[model samples]
Structure formats: structure tokens, C-alpha cells
Target chain A: MQENRSIPVMDVLIAVLLIAAGVASAMSARHLGKSVLEPIGPGAFPLAGSFLLIALSLLVIWRAVRVGTTKSNVDEFKPRPGMAVLALALTCAYFLVMQLEWLSFRWATVGYVTLLTAALFDWQPRKLPAAIVSGLIMGLGLTYAFTQVLYVDLPS
Target chain B: MEFLLPAIANVFTPMPFLMMLLGTTIGIVVGAIPGLSGGMVIALTLPLTFFMESTHALILMVSMYVGSTSGGLISATLMRMPGTPAALMTILDGFPMAKRGQPGRALGFGIMASFAGGMVSWLFLALLSPPLAEIAVRFGPYEIFSMTLVALMLISAVSAGSMIKGLLSGFLGILVSMVGVDPSSGALRLTFGVPDLETGFRLLPVILGMLVMSQVIGDIVNINQPIERVQTSFRSMFMSMNDLRRQWTNILRSSLIGTWIGILPGIGGTTAAIASYTTARNFSKTPEKFGTGTEDGIVAAETANNAAVNGALVPLITLGIPGSVIDVLLLGALIIHNLTPGPLLFQDSPEVAYGIIAGALVANVFMFIFMILGTPIIARLMYVSRAYLIPPIIVFCVIGAFAQGNRLFDVWIMLAFGVLGFLMMKAKIPTGPFVIGYILAPIAETQLRSGLMVYDSSFLPLLTRPVSAAFLVIAVLTLFWPFLMKRRKAPTAPAHLEDE
Candidate 1:
């Protein structure tokens, strides 16, 4: 577990950032204390959390130097483009739909259900009707199950 | 021994028994699907229990808890796709066997081992939980603070890259939890002047936001990706007696390791499974044969992960500290049922308390049947195209987030957190630490500040308080051990993860 693998220099940079954040946290803790709680007061756990992080980061770098290239999957980081954006957009829309109450619980369910299933199954525009129909059906079914049989009312 | 009979009878009641069977069968199917998770099942069902009597609802829930958790191995072993993150390690060695056309053996051993680990842990929970709760009754703010510190120390075990990032995420989580008006004083630390800020953030929304949404975002990034496929035969889903005889010791050892890890504060089942898998592989006679479809690897990982499910429940039941996010959801559900678990639960509601234990045992019995019977059926889900899987889940994620407390703003938070989660994940920050930190921050603050008050704002009292000092020492020791051990045996600390 302990090898002197040379750490990527960025680790040390991250450590420095951690130390700075810890100091800032400590200072903020003092400032907020007059109204909230004092330095190491409301901020005690977080301050400690930040400090421990700094130390742990330092240790990882130190160990990385000794135990170089410890794992093959270290660079397994990957990113997707439109999918993330689409998911985010859908989530944001879901939020707005809830806020306006323009869509009742049942409608909201159908909208989300249909959109999600199409998104999930990678459906095309031509298939939109089918997705919407199924979503509406499942939505109504769940709404009925919860509101009528289960007797749990959905929020407006 | 004599008291155990009554416990069995309590679980075997006609309705309770039927629910257990039904829950486990449903749990396995859901769990074996690649995109769905144990938490999702609990989330969807959480509302269903609100209308029911508590014990019956709990019976259904616990059966699902046991069954779904165990069923992760089916996909992990046969399809090379982990049903959940915990099963990821199972696939490392498991898929090789499936590729070699011995998937039945892998799946079989995983199922049987899951049953055994889950059953043994249930027994442990049944026997040990009451006594543990009794001990917790003696805990004061000093003791609780110490416990939180120990939990903080566990972050070292959970964090992946640099301990710094792990600890930072933990600290960040604590800071986030401090958003609402101060519980002790009416001052807001982080929240701006929104009325919703008064209650701070709801746990379910925040969790669903970060865990589920982040995942959806990650999926979206690769919506058009084509993944390789694995070929499988439903053949040989049974382990031979000799294979069984060879693995008894490995099974027991891994179950013990998983439970012990579960008993720890923040490590959860991911570490438990990895640890169990690593240990089983390291000690096996055919170590070289590992990662090439060895039966024991699947067994060890499957058993440990499932056992860890019950193991994680220990802290939730005894100390009121959730051992994982699922436990956090369970805690929320308990509140809905008017069943707040803690040291006093055993005294106030022995029937409810014992009922959960009895129910878990029942859950696992159902887990065994459902796992064995449903494996062939569930193995077919791997055939579902990813194109057909992603969109619907995103919709559910949106609805799930909205359903938590029904604030649309909360859904925004979920979307934001989802992207943030995906980013953090991309940046290699461990998500588990953020969650554990979030849950513990409030507790740690209340305990530490209260302890300070009890000692009249004096730092001297903190050092002198026997419990606090002991806990601090343990935390420090746990943190520095990796460093110390690294220094002494830098060449061979074994591996940090995946037990085998």
C-alpha cells in the first residue's frame, strides 16, 4: 500500500488549495461566530474536515512518489457531451414543471415518463407519439393507484 | 436458542411470510437490472408504506433490502455488467468465467454465498443489535462526538485518490449541511433569504439530486456510445459439492470481513465487497486463476456485499447514524412511520425493533429463492439496448427528485448536483465521502459544540473528557495508520481495494 510512486504534480497543487481553503474556513468561522458561532464553532467540523483533507492529500502525493503508477485504471476518466447536457436540461425542465404546477401530478408524471423513456430507449421523433402514449398510461395508472386505491393525494 | 424460536415464529406469520417472498422476488428482478438500484426500489416504495401499518410495511421493505442487494451478482457474474457499483468488483473476476462459458457456476456460487452471508449477518444483527443499543444508551454528547470523529477517520478508507480530496469532500458536505438557520441559534450560515432556506435542504432531494442525477448526466454524455456485448448460457447455475466444500472457509471469512467493515462508520458496501473479494483472492490456492472466472471470487464479492447490507443497518439501528445513503433513506422512511431508531427504540418499541430483525431473516430466505429462481430471467435484461435504457431512467430521476418533498427548486438543485456530481466524478473525487460528510456534519457540529458548552467553552475539557479524547486518539490513529504502514512496508501493503 505504501510505495514511493512519484505523484502527479497536480496532487501537490490540490494539496496547496486544500490548505488555503482550510485557512479561509478557519477565518470565516471566526467572522461568523459573532452572529452564529465562533471560529472552530459552527465551522469546527468543516475546518477539521478541510485540514484532514489537506493532510490526506499530502500523504497521497508522498505515497504516490514512492509507489509510482500504482494502478492501470488511473486514467479511466471519460466524458460524454450532449447526453450530459440533455439530462441536465431535462432535469431543469422537470423542476420548472413542478414550480408552475402547470402540469398536475398526473400530467407531470406522463410528461416525465414519456420524455425519460424516449430518452432512455433512444427513441426518434417519429416514435414520440408511442412514448407519450405509454408515458401517459403509466402516469395515469400510478396516479390512480396512489390517489384512488392507495388514497395518497399527489401535490398540486 | 430458546428465544430464537419465537423470533422465527414472528417472521413466519402468514402475511409476513408472503410479503417476504413477494418482496424478495421483486427485489431480485429490480436489482438485477443494470440501471436500477436498491435505493430506487426503496424510494419508489417509501410512499407505499406510509398508508400501511408499520410492521407489515417494514416486512416488505426489509425483504426487498435483502433480496435486491443479493441479486446484483446475477448481472455482475453473467453479463459482465455490474447491477450496482458494489458488484463492479464481482465482474472483474466474474465475467472471465462467463466468457469461458462457466457463468452458471459463477452465478450459482454468488447466489448461495449471498444467502449465507446475509443469513449469518441477520443472525448477528438479531443477537447483537439489542445489546449494542443497550450500550448506546450510556453514550453522552462526549461519546457521540468521539463516534463522529471515528466516522471521520473512516473517510480515509473510503477516499480513493489523495486523502486530501476525500477529506475535503467530507468537509464540503458538512459545510453544505450547515445551510439552513442554525438549529441552536436562529442565524443562517449559508442559505440566502429564501423561505425554503429556513429548513435548509431536504435529505432525499439532495441525495437524489447528487446520486441519481449525476448518473443521468454521465449517461447523457455518452448517449450515442456503442458498447461491446457479452455472450452467456444459462447453463450450470449450480455449484458442485466439492466446489462448496472448498469455499466454506472463504465464505465465512468474507462474511466476517464484510460485517466488520459494515460496523465501521462510513465505509459502506463498496469497500465491504472489494475487501471481501481481495481477501478471498489473496488467500485462495489458485490465486493465479483469479480474474479469469474463478468461482470463489464471485462468491466472496457477492457474499460480502450482501452481508454488508445487514451490516450497514447495525449503526443505523443502534446509533442513529446511517452507515450508507440507503440507510439514510431508511431513516427517512422510519420517521414517516413514527419509528425513529436510536438507543431508546429498543425500549420504546420492542415489537417494531424485533420485527425488523425477524423480517430481515425472512427477507434473506426469500432472497435465496428469488436469486436462484430469477437469475435466468434477469440475465435477459443484459440484452436490452442501452439506447432503450437511458431516457426513461432520466425521466424517473426527474420525477423521483420532484417527489421527495415536492419543491421544484429542489429539482433544480438535483439537476445542478447531478452535473456537479458528474464533474466531480470526472475529476476523480469520491462521491461517497460527500454523502457521508453530509449526513455526519450536523451530528458532528451538535456534538462538538455541545461538548464545548458542557465544559464551559474550555478546550482543556475536551482533552480531559475520557470519551472524547479516546475517540480523537482512535481517529488520529486510523488516519495516520495508512501513512505509517506505507512508510514501513511501502512495497507490499497489498492493494487498497477489492479484498481478493
Candidate 2:
């Protein structure tokens, strides 16, 4: 079976995003103070960087297109979108749920770890208990270790 | 010489010695874990040192630095996973050796070389840093600006990827650094009206997000794929004297290379390992054996990386210029202790400088002993499931971000950067330049402005001043060297595939 070697659409999207960011940054830099005596204003460095980023973004797009069109150029790996989405959702959920103050630090961490592990491993009967136990130990153990030993205050 | 005895006495004390031992142990464990890096550990551990003495804090951080740099070899050898960026080269031969049923031998070579490298570079650090400081103190703003620019260019040039992309990543990091209010003018340049923007992005969150959190996310996305972990016998964990004797020259050469690369501003141990590995390959009688489980490859990589760790400290201690990402954390540790890094440090607080130097020597000894004895134990970490390992790393990231300023806002920022880092990796953009760029941007800006003020805003002095001129010339040459090589190699290189 032939391997999938399509160009990453994400590259083009990132390039577009970076270009838009560059334009915004450059425009904002112009609004900052720039005197003849001190031409290297605080904005000057960022403005230069924005332009470079724009150029580089275009280069990346060009490279992506050129590579995508080639028949024999096999890009061996592709990003797994299903896994990517799942991970991002879990990450966002972790932060968002923490902010809502619905659960204490240990409980929230336990829930986050347990749910994420289960989701990643398909919630197998054998793996589920192990995941829950591991979550409990890490969540409670780390909370105690950090607060008491390291003196770091975790959000309640 | 005068400070040496005092420093030794200080480090030999129970608290300092215990802290070094604890830090080394923690660093090795952290660095052996696939997604956790030494810098991440140090950044997280920084807040915990708030109540500790300056000597204890420095000792802990220095020991961690040595142990973490050495710890990376274990995972790289056993699992083909580089625990830290510096260990990337180790995976070239380390895994191959493990696959050939010589995991212990490869690790033995790596650990021994790490010890040699660390000790050799510590000597250089002790002998050279003070004199280097004396000369560096005389540098004008223009020279410093040019030097930093050279460092940026060198890093971008040597970074893995197209040079332009590396440059972009670096500059973008500088753009990120610019988000806070300007330090000199106190004027907001790019905060976009957010109150958090006033303080700019903290290094801890930015670094954790980029280096640690991103890796966790990546590991999560690939958790279903199982990785084989190689085990080694205790007997094979130590090299024979004959084996050590044979590689002495290679070890010395690599140690030198690693130390030199480490001292260069903004560079890190990874580059040192690469340089040493390549140089060792070029000079080897059995060059073909390098990628085929040869001890030479592991020695070169391990030795150079550890040496570079110590070498990086030379600039950080003597000149306030950070030689690597980890040193940036050390710079923060110094500042937190009310000790400023630079030449004045030697005069204003000689004890701190001596303490660091002495700590490095003792830490290296500890790293050597721990790595040799604990090889079998740390190897088990390689078998831990990604599901079990990665989530805790994320938790650490959150705690690390929050601990920096005791703010929840930093946690969100870390999450955002985590996404950004993941995207950049997917796009093949190197993260090293970006992180280095962000860290150096403020220094670059301040130096540039200071230089401009001295030269009455004429940019000519940046090029005409002898030292600054030399540095700029080197930067330009370094930037173009890759292009020149690519052009020369273009005829033999296959088309289309090269661009990808």
C-alpha cells in the first residue's frame, strides 16, 4: 500500500496567520514613538522581526507547495488529527475546569488525569483501575509534595 | 585562589552537600523522563529555593545542571528518546547499541565520558572565567550588542532546519519578548492593552510551555504507539580500563569541543554534542562504526554535552551573558538571591562566585557517582507508560507557570505557548532559536540603544568599532556559510526532496 504524503494544510494556515500577525505588528509599531535621534525605538526591533516573520512564513508556504507537488518526495509522517484534537480538548478542559473552582486542586488533577488516561487508552477494563489508582497517587501525592515540601501554592 | 578554600569549606558543609546530592538525584530522574527537561525542573524548583541560602540555591541548581545533562543519555540509549535536546545526538548510536544487546556498555561509556567532560570543563571554568571577566568588563555597549547578534546568528545558522526558518523563529521570540512595557522608557510597545502584557511573558512559563508542555502534548497525541525499553545488566554498567584507555584521546577532544561550544554565548550542550560527534567521526579510524553501536559515538556525545554544561556557566558567572537556556534560569537564581551576575560579582560577592565554582566541581563528582550506580534504576523510567508520565508533566507545567509569579494568568499563557510550540514543531521550526531569541532580545535591545546613544545614533560604530566589527563580520560569515555549502552540494543533491 502507498503511504499518504500530502502537503500539510496546517502549514499554509500557519503561514497566513503569521503574515496577518506581521501586518498587525508592523502597523502597531508605527504608532509608537520614533524620533530621529533615537530611531531604534522599542517598536523598531519588533517591527523588523515582524517583517522577517512574514518573509519566513512565505518561504514556508513556498517550500510546502513545492514539496507537496513532487511525486517521489515522501513525507513519512502525518499529524494525527483525532489524537491532536483530543489532547487539545483535554488540555483546555483542564484549564477551564480549574478556573471554574468546581473542584479542589487534588480532585481536579485526579479527574483530569483519570479522564485523559482513560480517553487515551480506550478505557479498557484492565487499564481503567490502574489509571484511576495512578491518578489518585499522582494528584494527592504531588499536591502534598508541592505544598508541604516545595512550598508551592496550588490553586484550591 | 583565596576564595577557593572558603568556597570548598562552604560546599563541604552538610546543607550544601546534601542539597547538591538531592538536586543531582532529582535532576537525573527528571532528565531521564522523556518529556521532562533539566531546565523545566530548575524553573519549577526555582521558587522552592526562595527561603534557602544563596550558596545552597546555587549548589542545588549547579548539581541539577550536571545531573540533568548526564541523565539524558540513559533514555536516549535505552529507548531512542532524547530526554533533553542535548541528548539528541546520543540517540544516533546509543539506541543502536541497546538494540544490539549492549545497553549497559553504551550507558557506561556515556556516563564515564560525562564525568570526564564535566571535570575537564570545570578546570577551564576555574582557570579562565576570572581572566575572561577582567577582559569582558572593558567591553562597550556596541561590542556587547554585536557579540549577542553574533550568538543569535550562529545559533540560527547551526540550528536544524532551513536557516531562514530558524531566523524567523528567533525573531518571533524577540517579538514575544517585546510584549511587555519597555524597560528603559516604561512605555508600552506591544501589550495590546492587556494588564499581563505589562510584565511581558515570564521566562518560566514560556520555557515550560515550549520545552515541556509541548512535549507532553506531542507524547499524548502518540501515546497509543508503544516504545520498547532496553534493560542492561549491572556487570556491563562499567567500562573496562582498556576500553577507557582506548577512548582517552576521543574523550579529551570531545571534552574540548563541548567546553568551547558551551562558552559561546546563547549556544547550548546540544550543539556541543553535535560538533564533538561530527569531529570524532571525521577523525575516527573506524568512522563506519559510528552509527552502528560504536562506543566512540556515545563517548563523543556524552562527554561534550556534560563539558558544555560547565562551559556554559563560564559566561553566565563572569559576564552575566547566558551561554544556554539553562543558564538563563541560573541567571534568574542569582538575581533572586540579590546577587547580580557580571564582573562586579567577583568583587561585590566573591563567595557566590567561588561557591558556584566549587559546587560545580563537587556536583560533577556526584553526577559521576550517581550515574554509574543508578543506571539500572533510572533505566526503568523508560518503561513507564506515556499516559502515566505525560499527565504529571503537564501538572508540573501548570505548577511551574503559577509558581513563577503566583498568578493563574501565567498558566493560561503557558497553555497558549504550548499550542504554539506544538504548531511550530509540526511546521519543522526549531524551538532552540526561538527560546534563545526571546531570552536575548531584551539584552540585544538594551545594548543596541546604549550603543546608539554612545555613537550619537550613527550605526557606523557598530561596524567600525574593532571588536563589534569583528563580531558582525563573523555573524555575516556564519549566516552565509550554510548557503554556500548548499550551493556547492546542489549538483549532487536530489531535487524536490531536499526542500522538504
Q: Name the 10 consecutive residues with the lowest summed lDDT in model 1 chain B.
A: B491-500
C-alpha positional error of residue B78 in candidate 1 after TM-score superposition, expressed in Å = 1.7
lDDT of 2 by residue, B13-66 (tens): 999999999999988888888777898788767767877888899999998988
Task: Give lDDT for model 2.
Answer: 0.81
lDDT of 1: 0.69
Question: What is candidate 1's lDDT per residue for B46-67, written digit by digit as tens?
Answer: 6566677777777777777777
Taking all chains together, each candidate's TM-score versus the true structure is 0.83, 0.89
Error of 1 at B248 (Å): 2.2
Candidate achieving the largest DockQ: 2
For model 2, state the Cα shift of residue A37 in Å. 7.7
TM-score of chain B in each prediction: 0.87, 0.89
Query: DockQ values for all predictions?
Result: 0.30, 0.49
- CAPRI class of candidate 1: acceptable
> How accurate locally is residue B129 in candidate 2, as Cα lDDT from 0 to 100?
80
Task: Give i-RMS (Å) per prediction.
Answer: 5.2, 2.7
Structural similarity of chain A in candidate 1, as TM-score: 0.54
